[model samples]
Target chain A: MRAGKGLKWVTLLRRVADTQDTDAFAALFEHFAPRVKAFLIKSGADHAMAEECAQDVMVTVWRKAGQFDASRASVATWIFTIARNRRIDMLRRDRRPEPEDLNWGPEEEPDQLDILSLQQESDQLVAAIAELPEKQRVMIERAYFGELSHSEIADETGLPLGTIKSRIRLALERLRHSLS
Target chain B: MITHHLSDKLLMAYSTGTLPEAFNLAVATHIAMCDECRARLASFDAVGGAVLEEVSEPSVTMRADALSATLARVKAQPPVQRKVAVPPKDDVIPAPLRDYLGADGEIRWRSLGGGAKQMVLETSEHATARLLFIPAGTAVPDHTHGGLELTLVLQGAFADEHDRFGRGDVEIADEETHHQPVAEMGEDCICLAVTDAPLKFRGLIPRLAQPFLGI
Candidate 1:
């Protein structure tokens, strides 16, 4: 997250980055350190690795606080991005089993069509995706949100894995057209 | 056209950082090549920013020396590098999606147990776009989407309660749609998907392992 003049924390960070204010630095570190650690842990990192990476992320935050852009990215998004990059690097180190490989089942029932529908710019997208029909949404969500593989989605959805894959591909095309 | 599908709602969740790790990885891959999805995600990020601003701020208790310690370290380091910042990508999607989804994309494939292979495709400068590809015959236990479901199939086939779909087919199911699919025949199927929310897992073990599963 970039520090801006108006944002409460951004202002504080800008001051601390400019002047070596131990108190400000500590406050920033203390607030975000654990969250960063937990974020990493949630992304499949071990506790120790998460802690170490969290420290690294915070260190980067310290150095880059002056460059924080409140308009471009939220503090959480910036921190998350840092953590994400770190996790990606860790994942590249070696292959390990990923336990969270299941597929997301289906979209939660839309409470209201108005709320569920996307706005004008996004409306095109929403309409297009909505146009995909129920069957495709089922397969798509199971594979994409549920993180289920075609085979996995098939196993749970009672559909052939190949069928699930084809549906996803077609759904994407329709989305593209709607946006265009 | 790659014909890989990504939903607007899922794009929003992903941009908001609400998606589970597994699905997030897939969306990441599809977004890399699909600019339409990328633009839609940018809008989600904007909405997320507005929403986050409304979220109650977390408690801000902190040690007095935290800032000082952080400052001291930065002061001791070499001059930091600062690159000229560029404006973020647009919110308007491009036309003819294939060009975007077909661009040169690189992803790191990770194998989860039992013949299940996963890869996260990097989509944009923001890393907001992604595509997840899973081969046929892979089995993912029954589960649910975080909020929205979007799927597109490029090759092969899979079946469900409604019917079976081959290449160029699409589906958008909801909480009401719950069923498992096993790949048909010997051919593997490739799908493209995008989602926003994290999956609401079923069963105690899945719920317990949700955190570790990163889905």
Candidate 2:
């Protein structure tokens, strides 16, 4: 079943690249659209804008399927990279998105949150994170992975901004030390 | 003083993309020449990737027409290029010194006794912006920042605090930080610097070097 599923996606991608097949496109959309929406929403996007951007991303994927190269990147990575680039561009506009702008304040770092890893590079990073002090690990995750601003963290955890900053600094230092 | 060297905290904040835009810009410029920090940044990227994978997969069935829609769009778009075009060489202004200075800023880069040269990336507008580039085999007069100053080694290595940095090594400095950077035994050393205010020379020779050094 797993192999079949994998084959299905690979075929779907290949066909999407070669023939621009709509049925294949629809299938891909159905699988990824919601996830994309969730990603934007979780990253501080407003509900409406997130939905709009998610649709835009899916449409771009459809149009750009011919650009996909399986050897260099997995379908997920390609899509995620696209999403990230788009998000960065959107953030660079003259007017900023109010909902997406999180403030940076000080707060105590949280405990380590569970991390998911699919790629080997990500796995190495997870191991690196595991080596960090719990305080540093938690702050890093909450600030970066969770998309929470330092200020938000301070407000949420009631920690001083300086303390929060120090924890993150110490955490990065440890992570860098371990990785090195 | 812990030398706010931005604390590892600020560095961590930067790696995680939570830093303020201005601070991020400062650090980004620093990182462009600092390798030790870049490796740490890579690790933070990994942590972010791990978190992304943990999100539960969406449970939904593919609609019959989804593939056709995507395919139709693909037919209309062009192929992606293998690589983005490289920025023009002149546009790739080296960092550190380039950060606070405008692209068209006027300044003089004069060679000192050895290969060391000082060019004021930023003029006398403020007390804090200065940078000195030392070529290979050059020696810089020891000095300290009147404010916050950051040095980023863009090419080759220089030694001061008994540590060596190749390309992309960044050293942050302030009033309390004083070090004389001597270029490695081989190869020219080019460094980009950002200073808050300017330098305060403690010795006569160092004072004489400041104007030419543009410290």
Candidate 3:
């Protein structure tokens, strides 16, 4: 699965959110900061700017720690959102309107079983992406990482969807021509 | 309860942070109302998380002191969220749209004739977004779309030749579609409408007024 860290990142995030623990924060930063930097750079940030933005994102992770809900989102998913918003802000792109919140802040803890299942779903998703053909995998990376502009993104409603794809099915069909 | 959810294309674009601001507003506003779409959005977001978590070797690295700097930054800033389940407000405008409308959240309506009015929200150059008001028993002038148009009903209901859209329903129209939407009889209807291109009107009066109406 992941590296030598036996503890879940959610556990680490809980420590950060509840007690402001440095060791936990360091563990998270060590794991996530590099990836955030790499993601920003792929999204068209310069080396220096990506570094600064990654730092800012980590700080936000610290600040918004209490908002993380394992029942709903994995730590990587949450951090990806934070990094995406930071990219938009730093690039001075158009304001990204967030969907209305169904609920605000963290509430009661989700069932541990629910948390485990969601993380498993996320991990399965990662494996699924890894198993995709190289061309398909790159297409996904390009779309999420800012290589495709909004207009350049495909919207062909007529293309067929295979049963194997998930919610991203149509988006994949739309991204088909971009690679060519 | 949202029957007409956003297309997977729109939701995935939103999840990837690639949609125009206007479209983003439409999607977010719809999601605020539809938990199904929100759950769908979360799945799309997992794809992003998957991409981020994919173990590609980094060509770039964060400076060694990155964690220290982040910790320092957090010292001055308290954890900024207190998500205490703020009950959805009674106002017609949802939270994301409220920010763009009047600071008091009052919609300043401009007349579009036939008991329909509109308030265009300021978005980027990529697209146009507006709130549309149609009194009960009124019909918008017949029209077709040049590009994509997304309409999400917020209050009351409306029916066109295609289908009936109620609160939290999103009806998407593209170039080939043509319909005249009439508000359902029981209540005045309010909707959030976003378009990538201007609408084409068929009626002589509306055609003449199109230059001034900005529809």
Candidate 3 Cα outliers beyond 4 Å, as residue runs: A1-7, A102-107, A150-180, B81-83
lDDT value, residue B196 of candidate 2:
44
Q: Put the candidates in lDDT order, highest first.
A: 3, 2, 1
Docking class of 1: incorrect
Mind giving the per-residue lDDT tens digits that candidate 1 earns over B1-215?
Answer: 43435555555445434344445545554555454554445444433322222222244222345445545666676324444332223222112223344355333446544555544433332222233344576545467765445555545666766667555445565566666655566677665554444556677865775564444
| Better model by TM-score: candidate 2 vs candidate 3 | 3
Clashing pairs in 3: A104-B83, A105-B83
Q: Could you give the DockQ of candidate 2?
A: 0.13
Q: Show where candidate 2 strays beyond 4 Å.
A: A1-14, A59-74, A93-141, A145-180, B1-50, B53-75, B81-132, B140-151, B168-178, B185-187, B194-215
TM-score of 2: 0.52
* RMSD after Cα superposition, model 2: 12.0
Query: TM-score of every model?
Result: 0.37, 0.52, 0.89
**First chain TM-score for all predictions:** 0.48, 0.52, 0.79
Q: What's the residue-level lDDT of A70 in candidate 3?
A: 68
Compared with the true structure, what per-residue lDDT tens digits does model 2 show for residues A1-180? 123232355568767666766677677776666666665666666666766676678778766665553322235545655555455555541111111101111221112220111122333444555667778656654665336543344423222223222333344344334333
User: Where is the poorest 10-residue window by lDDT in model 1 chain B?
Assistant: B87-96
